[model samples]
Target: MPPPESSGPPLIGPLIAQLRLARRWSQPRLAAELCAVSDVPTLGRHEISRWERQLRVPGDFWLGWLAVVLAVPVALLVEAATRTRSLGTAPAVVGARSRSALLALAQRWLLDPGDPSFAAATGWLPPTGPPTGAGAAPPTGVPALPPTGAGEPPPTGVPALPPTGPVDRSAEVVRLAELRRLDDLSGGAELSGIGFSWLRRVARASSEATPVGRRRLLPVLAETAQLCGWLAADAGAPTDALEAYRFGLRAAGAAGDPALAGHLLGSASHLLASVGDPHGALVLARTGYAGCHTVASPRLRALLLHRIALAAALGGRHQPARCALAAAQRAADRVEEGREPPWLYWVDGPELAAMTGRALVVLRRPRRAVALLGVGQGSGRPRSGAVYGGWLARAYLQLGEVEQACAVADDALLDAVRAGSPRAVTQLTAVRRGLAPHRHRQPVRRHLALVAAAGPYLPRPVTGSRPDPTDRTAPPVGNGGADRPGTPARRGPGGRTGSSVRPVGGRPNGGRAARRTDGRAATHSETG
Candidate 1:
């Protein structure tokens, strides 16, 4: 096997490290976990450390072990290892056709937790948005939920609200509206981690807090699923997010509401694109947008096409990206503010500018990126605002304006910290790494220290890997230093690598996502 140069941590290493940390398992424990699942009599913690440190790949032989132990897609594990290896080597400069194939397999891990066909995506076109309950199918692994008639009723003492009375239904609606407003203020998660756990709690609460017929229940579930999906991705949990989206989709279908279903699927597609699953994102976006086009207002259609453009650009489909972008602009031009959906208030001009700039950056058109991303810098929405600021920093870095990048990075660090976005934090760290040659300078060092204070998993400084003649594919040699992947390995209990490290990331900031300063994909997977 060709060993790629390790200018930075290979894909497998940091992910192994992060996933292991998420499990709160020490290296030895992970090794043991592997052993129990593997045919190999035993694997050693030392080897696991090597894998995390990018010293040696376990090859395809160990993917099943790692996948089962980490509870992630086995294909994803392979993709990580492959990406890291590719980076260590330089791009061979393949054709567009070959490139798209590689891109599809990049971070496009089929996230449906129960989709047996997860890794079997055919040409990256996923199920398009189907009208809910119009022969909508459940994921392969989801056990059929019982009919409400056969389902258990609430206990006698359990709380029950009058079914769909004007006042009772309005109470739930009031709470939902409040949550949305508060979420905007708090940057997505509040009332305890806007994530899978929180979503579950809310779902349970809604189920028990009110008694209603299918009419009321479906919309509630759809809305809950939508928020939960966002939160799950926000907290760096893609699989969980995918599950939430699928459930929300089901609810929308059951409610026979194309508006809700289209919105949910479109948003999910946007998240996928942001997370490096652009093909899946594109497919989902197309599915949802097509259905919504006739029914949704022009502004909403623009938002939908905006997401599609982003995914296409990231996937290296320049023509499609450009076409979609143009279409989105045309749609935007035709917008009628009065006819907007409740959720589309956030999808205005500034957001459009930001998304466009982001797509430009991924396509490596830095000049265009700089202009638009700058406009996006002060977006009031904290999450995308922080990300847009990061993009600004990256655009500056690409133009070789180190000082400007530093200034923007500092601003981004603050916003990202407030937004609790791990990806933005790491993107900022990559800026620092790009400035490694100038680390002797005060601004870089000062900023690095401040970023370090943000959280435990903030990127630690790392020395460059020694060059290897055999691996010629790594990106053009940088300051001879780059941000090495993996948490600093400290010996933890039982002589294992650090397990106390926390996983960090906001939603996969993939579409309209900023690349690291060195022009590498910020990450194909999680950020922190």
Candidate 2:
């Protein structure tokens, strides 16, 4: 067993304790229940006590049994275990100090790839060819990409394609944009493997291209990296997501697109803020805005500014956050259709309103938050609705509107279930905690029971094997360093817990419902 002192903040332990307590079960009771459910009589009170106390982490056997007895998803327990094991060890510092170092980090992420086993288990397969249109269905029976080793080339018989000119590049970008739209429909958990596969293919193609061709392909690679990073973060693989963002930043720099680089930086900043590193998030957000302020399109500028506003709010810089929010609103107002990059397609009025509302909630201006968040709530995206509505519910709670809070929370919970977003669920968890004092109310009790019933079926974070983090690179910012993923809770101003909102990326048609392969209605998924 690992030393108790080095075990960081005890993710699995707290999670186990929370679940156990939620059911009003003591250590011996939980152990007995586990043994009874799994037909294994060996587990006892001492073992359960050790696991909850962080003296010893549960192994896979116990984890499986615990999931069964506790009525939670096994994947949740698995992720908690992975995070617990990693917490004690210092994260490998893959700082983006230089281009070469960044490339090395990218290579390491490429080598690790996604968890193919999980992908297979979930019955998700990457598309056989590039996405063709908004309604395109991913073809079935495509063989999975073979695993590769360090310094090894891509799988045999899969030769890298030569880079093409503007027309082909545009086609690739359009294809990726379509994929992004698809992601908005299906949650990241479903498409993360596909995103990684696409990134690997594009990275390989870029590597083989001549200098001129590479320049063309580099932008595509950068775009692919952005999408991959966004999906990875949404799926709760923060390490992979960070690596993808860093790789994209390098590619965007090499392609000489400060706007694209800024977008990557802003995306990374959003990831950092979500994982509880507000200081680092603010630094990167400021850096991104600074880098592209002069050249970014109206929509991109708004997106970047919004990132800064959100980061600042999370970090407790009230005045700066307010200023950034105002600037972002102005930028959003000036957006011209068809004038922005394909990647900025999701940044629009409603999205901006949602983000601004989230900032206001963080600032404790619940009344204003309710108004802006209401406008944002009109976006039909299920995941966005779940997330923003959870915040709206919190705002209601702050005003002591228990009935309204519970009603909104009920809708948010339904959306969260439909979207299959872990972040949405986590956000709702916070809202549920906020409603604890009102549990005596009928509405609150109904919502609480609903949430409890839905817990096991909700999607859990899909984590892969940990990456090698030996090298450090200082990303574009001079003094900023890579923020560690999975930090413990951070307290904001006035003793409020720092909360995170989803990254910027507007879904198509304000998250209009899409059709799935089975001809069923498709709901919006988590963006970051």
Candidate 3:
């Protein structure tokens, strides 16, 4: 029977734990209660303890019943078991497949949560501006902005309120959940709007909150706002992104989440650099460095400092850039696996090296950029793949290798499609731009068209110069990202997170409603 066509080894431990956590039950509590209810004497505290810690597997019958109790299919359990066995022999395959499965399973749980109809709806284009049911009176006593000293300027160097008071736990959690949902569903359009809304809401909610909640929710709020600002920039809304980041910086500082604040600042710096404001990016990175020192985790510190280095390089500050890069290397080298924070999950040596390589490219060293980013050239991982493709395209174009540049551009374009991220979209746009000098050539032109066709799904292209009209404003009300294929009157090419195009000029001060080309509401299946 071809050795039962082995699929992979089981990733049973984590799968079981994830399922259990989704149910929100303690191991001992479940053991005692389920043992009595299921009439399985063997399924006692000891067995439950062992299972939770991954020390031992339960018997076959118990396994089947446990799957039911956890609301996980029996087939999934078998798949995990097979993976575990295969992992013992083929570790690489097992690891890759197992990680994919984990992420998939988590996404599923997040989407359905065991009650699909009762979920938060969380359409790709969420209601903008303010949430429903928010109490009236602007959260009485809440400080709108943080207090500022006479000589201390705000992070954005704009006159704004300084952060104060504690974060409201309930309100903050709701806001984060909303932002996270939007992030998962949409690409970039609503990122800034929602982020800005969240900032206003949280700032108001936290006015009279306590110290404990403030500390806990501050980091979350900062991260949320930073993501908003970053996405806004990716959508060709640099100014909006900056405003979002500014608010996020204050929240991060107020909550004492120095590491998180540093990371947000780094993100803001990257946006600044992308929008021909490298000097601004450099300043933001330096500010981030000041905060990075307060973080306890080496991995977090390293990642933040890496951003500083990249920003400085883009800003033409060679000495400080090199110094920051060296510090980042040292900190990264000192970080131990499994000890880093969640945000630093994807920031590894390779990712950092890619950033440094891009910095080299920006500093007019195309050859070095290629060398730095070319590590793990054949790896399928999107993060490294996108960066390598970008650098290669730039390098080949700089060397006047027209054919090679086009080839690399094609690869980068495909990578952007598979990765489905704003960062990838931005990098791939660099590849497209590099090939623009040869735009008349068939291969380059064709590739550019393909990239443009994919535009609706991709993040809006962000140029360091003037914005593209398609990106600067939403399509006419009747047309939007969510238009159906072959729908003549729809007015737009594609849909992202069910977003309908916003009208040009001006709309309502509150969030604009999704509309069609004829200035009417349009609906698609994905909106559900």
User: Among these predicted structures, which one has the highest TM-score?
Assistant: 2
Best by lDDT: 2
How much is 50 displaced in model 3, in angstroms? 64
Q: What's the true lDDT of residue 500 in model 1?
A: 19
TM-score of each predicted structure versus truth? 0.53, 0.61, 0.49
Residue-level lDDT of model 3, residues 1-528, one tens digit each, is 011111133345556656766778777766755555454444455445434323233333445556657777767875654443332210110111212222222222222224221111211121122111112111112212343565666433122232345545665555555554444433343243335555555555444345565456556666767666655543444444544555565565555466676676667656545544454455455555553555547876676666666667766877777777777777778889997766555566666777667666766777877777676455666434654676777877777887877787677767655543445555566666677778899888787787778766553322222221112222222212123455332211121122221111112212232221110011000000
RMSD of 1: 18.0
Which 10 consecutive positions of candidate 1 have the poorest summed lDDT?
A: 501-510
Distance from true location, Cα of 465 in model 1, Å = 34
Sequence-dependent TM-score of model 1: 0.53
Write model 2 residue lDDT over 357-424, tens digit each, in one string. 88888899999889988886747788888888888998999888999999998888888877755666
In candidate 1, which residue ranges exceed 4 Å CA deviation? 1-167, 187-212, 436-442, 456-528
Task: Point out where model 3 deviates above 4 Å.
Answer: 1-186, 190-201, 208-212, 294-296, 375-388, 417-433, 436-442, 445-528
lDDT of each: 0.52, 0.60, 0.49
Q: 1-528, model 1: which lDDT tens digit per residue?
A: 110111122256657866887788899999888766553443578667656644344454466557777898877876766654443311221111112222222222211122222212211211112111112232222122222232455233211221332324456555555555555544322211323333344344444443344346557667767766554444333443454566666556555566676677776676666555565566566656654467778887777777777777877888878888888888889988778866666777877887788777777787888998887666565656667777777777778887888888888777776654433454565566777887887878887777778655332111121122112222211111111344243332233332211101111111121121211122211111
Winner on lDDT (1 vs 2): 2
Error of 2 at 473 (Å): 17
